[model samples]
Target chain A: MGKRPDRRESFVVRLYVADREATAVRAIANLEALCREFLPSGCELEIIDILREPQRGLDDSIMVTPTLIKLAPPPVRRIFGDLSNRGRLLDALGLTGLELSPPRP
Target chain B: MARKNQKEREPRLAKAQTGIDGVDEITGGGLPRGRTTLLAGPAGSGKTVLALQTLVNGARRFDEPGIFVAFEEGFQQVAANAASFGWEIPSLVQKRGRRSPRLAFVDGRLSPGAVQAGTFDLSGLLAAVEFRAKEIGAKRIVFDGIDVLLVMLNDPRVERGEMCRIHDLLERAGVAGVVTMSTAGLEPPGSFMLSLSDCIIQLTHRLAERASIRGFRVVKYRGSAFIANEFPFAIASQGIEVADFGTRPKYRVFTERVSSGIPRLDHMLAGGYFRGSTVLVTGMPGTAKTTLAGAFVAAACARGERALYISLDEQPAEILRNLASVSIRLERYVRSRLLEIYADHPQETSPEEQFVRMRQRIRAHRPSTLVIDPISAAIRMGGQSTVLGVAERLLAMAKSEGITTLWTSLYQGSEEAMEATPLHVSTVADTWIHLSYRAGRGERNRSLTVIKSRGTGHSHQVRELILDDRGVDLADVYTVGGEALMGTARWEGERAEVATQRDVEAEEARKRRELEILAAEIRAQTEGLERRRESLAAEMRLLDQSITLRERNESRRQQEVRARRGGEPASRAGRRKGRSAPTED
Candidate 1:
């Protein structure tokens, strides 16, 4: 057994996409923009292609695409669908203070 | 010396590698640090490519060293195939030095031969893999086509027995490895290797219509969870790529409704459908379900959004021509790549394979809307569980991808309903359209009604449908005295009788009016005749009186003139007699 070290805490905003192509490309672009605007510099933004690496898609029990999983905060949260709604997305991701206004209908 | 010291400072766990890009994000990092995964497939199913790609991906994408153990294909062939895909494996091996290169290939056949013609049992292969692993300090390893090793052994039981031994050897060596198995005749029963591996990925290829469809399903991935559906995959010059199997991204529900192309249907669905919502169209045989679905595809294509139509029942050419007869030109859209038609019989392929193929095509095309004409046939291709599971996964996948999906179902009787209903489909669907033929008065009338539509108000009344060369049209409901006819046949006989009775009454009334006018003319003429007769009688009387008076006068004269010879005759006589008698008078 290896010696135990000090416990380290990290914040990661993971986006589980169906594949690495058109929709995912656009989603990655949007998420990158969002992260640039809202997330702290030290926080990590991880994008996982569920189709390329299906085990990951399964580990999270993700049945849908473009699902964003916020792992940093306790009680892991998930927001499904397109991440176009900035306010709801920010709220779901626990970035409420940095939330943007709701998009027009 | 400084670089070596820096490398020594790096953590050991950091040395572990994942073969696929963007994958480390989900496994909490990657596949367990030092575990074996078996990549299994039948002949020519791209098993070798997958293994080689994994090795190369690990080397280039993750900075992890890897080793390829070739048992079937020669080193040159493997290198050449990889080179065609733009992978310069030989150069990478040369650049990193034979000692610390990122990749190396070990010939398994030579390993046994090297051991005094009595090679070190399973230890030889393990040692070579580990030797190469340590030489380049490789973190990931792949055994390209392990079936050669299995075939080298004469005893079948011994071959099966060696699986655990090989697995243990790899585990002890701390090298994460993937073994390729040629499924050939070695299916579940024959391949005892399946039970020994930590992860099992089965690749399949089905030759259909001169087009080959390739797919893979993870039968088991030990500790890690994976999307259970057999995801569709493709092998091109670049490598294997899986189709997107994620949930549709949630978009704000657009309030606008797009026409279904069939005007009567549009009215039935309450003026069209909301964008980004799924609609289910179901019906019996010859109910124009395909026509309705085709119209939807045409409408979507006309709107300039790429539309995909997957037909599990008919041929693409026939369906296209069928639509063209109704004035829907799909060929133009097809030429523009805005419309794609995929047609195949369900019996010709497995449902899982079919789903994968569909996903691959969808991913490639990225159509705005997808239509599965008669999803029932697609589901029936697989067993009940497989069909349900595939549908569940597919619906979830489509919804997540933000692609509006329309699935058609055949309304079979209760006995077969369980398999055909796609019961779970309703849960994911935003709208449901039920089409049925109402039989009445010896004629069958087609009707469309919305059984349910979420987030939008829709009509509940069953609307009559008209499909012709001019396209579908909604006619004013046939209503008599405020009651709409249930069906054309049901109302025909009674309506005809009522119309005939009305015509008879009109004819009788017209004849009576003519008789009245004739009777009035007859009465007027009779009155005039009576008056004339009276006038004639009066005239005659006057003449008679005059005659009588004249006669009297003649008689008086005659008395005087023999007297006056009775007036006239008597007057003539009287004149003569009076002339004779006048002298005497």
Candidate 2:
């Protein structure tokens, strides 16, 4: 169930990959940067490498590698391939007009 | 994790036993163990089924756990499909009570809209297989339609690399693997992947003259000898059964005799047909072939032995009705389970498929006798080679099981060759009865001829085939002027012989009566002659007596004359002469 977080403005995203393949590494890094820039202190990210945990990928019906799904802020959206398209990811996450928050230690 | 180095412990020469009907024999045992075996075939050729069945059979028979990775179908769909063959996939895959699961299925089907462009691999599928194999301690794994997953990559390099990785993964896991690949047309799957596998099997389906034939070949087997021919197979209700045409079955020669349902016919066949021998009843159309077969089956059932009658032209009810016309009631036997009638249209399936079904039926019913009425219809399903192949196998199967089999074949041509039968089964059959029609005497008459009866004396003369409500009866060969007679001609010939015999007998009786009358007339004439003689004798005696009296009187006169004057003697002599003359008259 992709439900909205309770009592707080939260960001939840899941990134699927196959071990440390280049596209998977790039997708993880790009997704982390986007979460750090957009959701600041309240962002939660769960990265799943199919190689390590294929059952979870099967449960999520993940067919492609380096797939990202935004599971919060009301509606859920998915992006396939490398997560290098920052604008499309932002638009998919419904953060079109959101400002970048300062990085937290 | 106490995981051992499975690669180091693998047996290089060991093979995984495929519990299919004939696959193990074809592969000289089974596929190379703990290695990848590629199963390639066209769609609907039973590639997925063969792979899945191998896994199921392995788990069930060999006590080996298995994992199934479906790349084209979901786990639920696969389970549902397997259910048709009576394989309880759910129970095999899930744990209930304290019993551990022997099988696991992973659905790897891709969604319609799901697409990837960046780096990707089948590592996820590998991980799923490995995890499940570890959980259940599986020794066998099946990848149903791995080509589907391979096609998804769209990159040849990655696909190749992933294929190698999967091979390596299976090798390291020390589990036997069957990777099924679906192909189109005749060209096989990727040669690289094929070369990398330990063994390769190819399955194909082709339709020939209204028959759909499924065949498989063991293309290559590493470190083992195998049968490399393309063997036809069928997907029966009990899964797949491969037909090995090359195997020469061993048969026991049974000495017991069985009645042919016709006492006279059995007399023609010595005592009766040999118990484990094959009887072929060949004839033209409307020659009572089915009726003859029915008679044999009925007789078998009467003997209290199970009988199976497979009719390709008529349904079971129709066969029963037709059999009843000949006073052969099979319903009682059927109801009592001593007789089983399996009737289906010859056009319903290929000859091979029909044979497979028959094999299954035989296994289930364990019939002591089998009758295939009009086997020509079944032989017509395929070409000459196929027909011959099926015939050989069928006869061998029946003989090996000591089943007395009867088959009727129809010859449609005008010329009659008693020695040559359809499907060329005459060579292997123990007895052959040929029925034909003679277009003479203004009516077509059926004649039965025993072409060949091995190890027994048979009647050489063609007898008249009479089929009636009383059952099949072969009339004694009625011949006239060196030609065997039939129908009205036969009846006429028989009548003429009887009439001739009656004429000879009547003529002899009349001659005897005339001789008796002639002897009586001769006797009467003899008696009349004797009576005449007696009367004549009486007359003669009377005359003599008269003469004697005259003489005496004459003498007395003479004496009186002498006294008077000697003149009476002359008068006496004259009286004597007169008496004599009267007596003579």
Candidate 3:
């Protein structure tokens, strides 16, 4: 949780994971797609593998893998799990509205 | 024989001592090492305090670094809450010199009001704890209030998975772990949570008789023997302490007698109280309980021994002043450092704190004699019934240290209730002296009876206590006509007895004087009669002499007449003699 931002601050998000595992890959892809769709101004995404940089996980107070942390807002927030819950995930990231296209079968 | 030998050679499960006072003893040596212990209890049941205290003890006493993952409380809040306990936790969390922090707190609380997303694993929590454990080289960790975090997860399946992850991570790190869960009633968490751990400790704090009573139970301990009964516990100033934790120490026995300060009371006890034995003095209020205790302290101090008087309800100044009125002066002993009086208000603090404070003083002073005046007044205040636990510990400690102690307790109701001492500490006392108020003749009189004195003969008589400016003394109280003669009745009885004895002596004197007068009168009468008889005998002797003279004269005359005128003279003499002859005839 680095800088406090103004009202127009871009969402600088970081995802903590243990290497590029399947769950981590899924969370990364889902978060990037959601950010590109909603954050037209700008969005910065940082990936951290806890296996290599575990201290970062402690500094961020991460309790689960594939954790998404929106750190650049005035008040930083954390979302847990593998990003499978798109509706609640969007709600947690302050990107609620605008129903996306139907999921591919 | 070979199988037995192999069994003996096999290694036993290693244990990591939590260093909590009673926890280690109950678990046979704390939780299993490199394994998890499931701690379940209701809210406000001291679960969090127990967990945090374990971590603190591990860090301070065992030199084991510990991590506390606070789920319900933040780092600063936890530290602030624990500061009142006099533990140096805040300083321990900071780096000192070249050594790593002995204890560290990690906030595992999820963002407030953040509804649970679809599904989530505890990789983030696990990773954070593991990272901190490695950084501090922690050998012990406690996820305090884990139920708060789990309830938010909202799914039993996910909760089970997360608990397993925590267990596995701690096992891999070779760290002793404690996961605390909130329970309702007697029901613990899901079976999976219970089955996954090597130990289970259940704690409960509930109200009994409008007072809180905390309980501790070790449900199961794998690969170890443990005491299975539930024990009363308390969240004292130091931490949680279980009642009846250690082997109840055998009371110290001694043959030497020490005075009870009252010489007659000593005589009633044969040779005073046995040294190193606890003595209980029970009485109603205004029965001079403190005076008896003061007398004991004064006696001990006079013998050049140290004494500690713990007055749970009275101040030292007031105690000294009151004792002075009874002529048992203790100020000199206090000034000489031979006696120390600890004044405390049991109402102001829990019995656990009271016990700890007393024990600390006893250890510091090492007094050979101790007096807890009217322990009943404060032993069971309007709070937890932990006083019995405290009483046991205090008494056991006193016995082990060979301290001769005297405790006074207040008794109400009738004679039947006299045997029931508050906290039942009388059972452990070697001697009990009960003081009662015998009301009669419109007056109340204080009397003392020796209820029991083990290993020594004691008087069964109830002696009336006389309190005045001359100090305390026991007066013999006698029963007359089925009533104990006391006060004015005793004085009247004594006076009446003296008067009866005086009257009996007066009557005896009168009878003795009359007999002496009768003997004198009989002696005078016999003397008068003897004198008269002597006089009559003298008169008869004189008459005989005269008659003999006359007869000689008459015979001479007759002889002359007969010579001169023979016949004529003889006739004349015959005539004179005739009358005499007639008379003779």
Candidate 4:
């Protein structure tokens, strides 16, 4: 196996969304906010527009738009539905114990 | 008002031929073009295969490019599964030409990370389909197991909305598409896809009569006509073939005749069965039904025409042996490839499967004649309606191909059953020959009766069937006092007639001998009288001689003695008188 890359560099995240759609826009903004706030060490993020690159979406087995996938850092995690609930999104991403904002009441 | 009239005008929907053998026949021309058709069925009901085959056949046959989007199975799996039927999917998809049809497959099967952190619609699926269709200029599309993807969305509202969106997208793209949905408990009671699609075809599989039968029906078709009855379909080695009664082939009347292999039977049928006609030979057990069918097969093969015999009750070897006893030699024809006998147990497969296999064999063999030995066994495999459907399709196929067919039906001896006709096969059959046992005259005799023969004159008399080493033989019906006599009874009648004729001749000969004896007696009596008269005449002659001598003496005496003459003359006179009397006598 190849040498383990840097922690933040190894983590590759991709978010699939339809181009210019309302939920897709919100999902991208929310994902960006989550990455910036949680993964302060920086994480590789790629946004795929299903409308523009449908083949990529099909290849990735994306049934719905605005689907998030953590490709690297082992034990890949997935979250669905625009990532609106920050706590649930973090929990689904396996980042619950990581340094981040406290849960809202 | 003119603009409103133009808006209100109904646009005629274009039809897209599915290119499947019987599907397009059931769906009018095909599903309404540039619209969505919902194909819902349980797993293993061939929903995926049906959709994929439409695309495959469209690409191969009609020069219509198509896109196949699979949500459950992978593209490779689909291609490999189709490869068994000799449908090369991967190559077909890869092949491209300037104007030739093309095939594109989009695998929409979800992985573990497929759905994550996103509020998504069916845009991804729609985009993939549209992009591929556009890339290949496809005019047909298929979404296989799309309901699985919808179910994964975990919201009925999203599923309904997604179904509507997909319908609109397919219609706007102007590509005729078929969408397959899985209905194994994941489907809600009231289906969203069924309501949104322009046409909905439901496929169902059930176990009946100890076998699994698959069926499909067009639940709804908007702005078009379709077959509503649930038609039986089979997933054969090639693909799904539905037995659709709506598109039943109309066959022209064939005037030619085919022999039934029995000369007397041919005579009974007025020169055999009409070409392309269905002949039902019904009888009780031990009536040689199969043997009669064997004769038909033998005749077909003898005429240098191919024959197919489906032996459901007996194995091919057993049938050959049994037929051989009756001098119907099918072994040589089988060896010569002029005849093919397919032997299968009725309980081994469903009636639908048997029908499909039979059709496949027919297509492969293209026989001029087909025979089903004891079709009663096949009828027993399913409900009356199901079996009738199978039988009807078989008969239709045979008729359409102008193949003479003979089906043997076993009928128990009952007035109602025999009169009513078992399974209504009598109606479908062009000619029906009923055979039964005559248990009279202290022996069992087989009788063959032509119950009904259409389009030609047939003998109504029941012929006594005599089966020997020379095959089936029909004897002239013998009736005494309006009662048909057979076996010992007929022989007894003939014997009695012969005896009566002999008795009359003997009595006449005795009377003639008595008359000859009486004539001999009368002649003997007459001969005796004649003999007496002759004797008397002889005596008289002798007497006359004597009298003449006496008279002479008397005269001499008279001369001699004059004095004594008186006494002598008197004696002489007496003597003369006596002599004269003798002479006159």
Q: Quantify all predictions' global Cα lDDT against the true fold.
A: 0.67, 0.80, 0.79, 0.80
Q: Candidate 1: misplaced stretches above 4 Å?
A: A1-105, B1-29, B34-53, B59-65, B71-103, B110-137, B144-175, B179-256, B267-271, B412-420, B441-443, B476-585
Whole-structure CA lDDT of model 4: 0.80
| Error at A10, model 4, angstroms | 5.3
Compute each candidate's TM-score over C-alphas.
0.53, 0.77, 0.78, 0.79
For candidate 2, the docking band is: incorrect
Q: Residue by residue across B441-556, what tens digits does model 4's lDDT show?
A: 67899999898999879988888888999778888656678877788787676666665677779889988888888899999999999999999999999999999999998887
What's the distance in Å from true for residue B531, model 2? 94
Q: Candidate 3, clashing residue pairs?
A: A62-B124, A63-B123, A63-B124, A63-B125, A64-B123, A64-B124, A64-B125, A65-B124
Say which docking band candidate 3 falls in.
acceptable
Candidate 2, clashing residue pairs? none
If you superpose only chain B onto the true chain B, what TM-score does each candidate give?
A: 0.60, 0.79, 0.76, 0.77
Write the number of the candidate with greater TM-score, choosing between 1 and 4. 4
Find the candidate with the highest DockQ and give its number.
Answer: 4
Leading candidate by TM-score? 4
Residues B1-585 of candidate 1: C-alpha lDDT, one tens digit per residue: 988766664334332444432233322244444566777778898888877887788888877778887878767888999998789988777754334677887765432211111111344345445555666777777777778777665456757655676677567767777788887644643367877777777778875443456666767766565555665555654665553334344555667787888776676666787776788877777777777788888889888998989888888898888888777778999999898898867776666556667776788889878888877876555455556556766666676666777888887554235334555376667887776776655666776767778876777666666667877655434444644455554346355666668877999999999999999999999999999999999999999999999898777765664434444575577457656755654
The TM-score that candidate 2 achieves is: 0.77
Tell me the spans in candidate 4 whose CA falls farther than 4 Å from its real position. A1-10, B1-12, B76-86, B95-101, B113-115, B184-191, B481-483, B492-585
The order of the candidates by lDDT, greatest first, is 4, 2, 3, 1
